[model samples]
Target: MRASPADIESICLSLPEVELGISWGDRPTYKVPRGAKGRGFLLYRAPGKTAIDPVSGDMFTDLLVIQVADEMTKRTLVQDPQSPFFTIDHFNGYNAVLVQESRLGELERDQLVEIIADAWATKAPPRLVREYFANR
Candidate 1:
């Protein structure tokens, strides 16, 4: 089954030290309480002028911006033909991938959990990361 926005929020909040916040007024954002300026790991994106549907020319409202460990990770996901993850011009030079909510069925629930956990680890402090891994 496809994941919903509520599912995303629940997964994000499941990570250690994750806090919910709003960005751009209402878009949901998840952050780790560590790192410079409190690292944001995930965001619900509303496509701006830079990101639009090629066929319909409409902005994507059900988009997610998920932070990856690095450019390589982002590239791998976006470049894979089977991956639901993609990127737009707005995300150039950024270590993140965009996924459509409606297309989330492309990934299994456990896969989604791993992605979110990896994202949290990228933003989470070493101590927290160590603790998380030790528990697992």
Candidate 2:
């Protein structure tokens, strides 16, 4: 089933104090402001079951090491007392949640199957992904 624009809007508004926008991928992304640098989050949408379907938003990611620009900042994120996801600074405050352990159950298997089909289509025609975004 195709997702309605209203469906997308509902998801964005459900987030707490979120600022949403369409990213380069032509999918929804969000910016969450925090008191400190690199304390942001991305409301990223990844490929879904259908070539046109998109996964729901319900995941968070910590920074990775390689993404850190300087040694001091890297140490700060890694050593932060309230650190959630280790190596979070590596993401530079930009990460997407396409997979997670749902309380409901394992990931929706159907969702994965459709995503692969869409990915294959993209590989077969690079412009297809871009066009998909444009349509969204």
lDDT of each: 0.84, 0.33
**Candidate 2 segments exceeding 4 Å error:** 1-19, 31-41, 45-71, 88-136
What would the TM-scores of all predictions be?
Answer: 0.89, 0.24
TM-score of 1: 0.89
lDDT by residue (1-136, candidate 2, tens digit) is 3332234334333433334545445654443321122122333334332212124342332111112334454455446554321332224453221222121122233432333223223222335435544664
Error of 1 at 31 (Å): 0.9
In candidate 1, what are the lDDT values of residues 85-124, reduced to their tens digit?
9999878998889998898887888789888899989988
Angstrom error of the Cα, residue 2, model 2: value is 35
